[model samples]
Target: MIMPRKGGKEAHDEMHKANPNLKVIFMSGYTADAIHESFGLIARVPFLSKPFGPSSLARKVREVLDTQ
Candidate 1:
């Protein structure tokens, strides 16, 4: 998982370029909608917002893991 700022997306892209099968889950303080609206990247990766509860985090991780 990564934060989409300060070259985060660049690094993620580089990793994906090296390994197309890489599964990424982006975490941000911003809401998913905000991230999508601002960066137009919701279609590219799974995301989890900050201040989430353990259950939410676990569920998201499980969802990503299952998909990948």
Candidate 2:
């Protein structure tokens, strides 16, 4: 997961360029729509909003892992 303060999309793009098969689960305080709109991440990438509990985090992680 990447938590870039700025240039988040660029960072993600670079990572993907380096390793296209890398699985990423973006976590942010912003809503998923906001992140998607801002980053142009229209792809079905997994996302987790901030302020989540341990179980929530765990569940999201598992979901991402399972899909990959």
Candidate 3:
């Protein structure tokens, strides 16, 4: 579940309740402080910032999934 840091807090919170076990990769170019303030701490996973290289992102995805 990849959700934007945009939209209101309600949208972000709703997603977790729907599927708490879902693996989410909250991608945001904004700083970590901004994301935490808006969405609260995600125990599932951290976020991916913008401008990340393709291979790095792919590797991350694979690593996350591989753990499952």
Candidate 4:
């Protein structure tokens, strides 16, 4: 589950609680202050800041997916 700040984090949180096995990869184009305002602590999730290159994006996705 990939949840950016644009969509409500509550939805993700609720879904996450229901299925704790889910691995959420969050992305954000907003600044730190904006991200804090938009979202609370994303429980058991990896956060990926935007403007990332292909290697970082691919590596992260692979790292998460490979573990599963």
What is candidate 1's lDDT per residue for 1-68, written digit by digit as tens?
A: 34456455777779989999988878888888877777667565888888889999889888988984
lDDT string, candidate 2, 5-65, tens digits: 6477778789999998887878899999988988889759888898889999889888887
Which residue pairs overlap in candidate 2's backbone? none
lDDT of each: 0.78, 0.83, 0.66, 0.68
What TM-score number comes out for model 4? 0.59
| RMSD after CA superposition, every candidate | 3.0, 2.6, 4.0, 4.4
Candidates in order, TM-scores: namely: 0.75, 0.81, 0.60, 0.59
**Number of backbone clashes in candidate 2:** 0
Better lDDT candidate (2, 3): 2
Better of 1 and 2 by lDDT: 2
Query: How far is 8's C-alpha from truth in model 1 (Å)?
Result: 2.1
* Model 4 poorest ten-residue lDDT run: 1-10
- Give the clashing residue pairs of candidate 3, or none: none
- Report how far off residue 62 is in candidate 3 (Å): 1.9
Q: Model 2 Cα displacement at 47 (Å)?
A: 0.7
Q: Whose lDDT is greatest here?
A: 2
Cα lDDT tens digits for candidate 3, 1-52: 2347646346656887897765556677876677777667554555677869
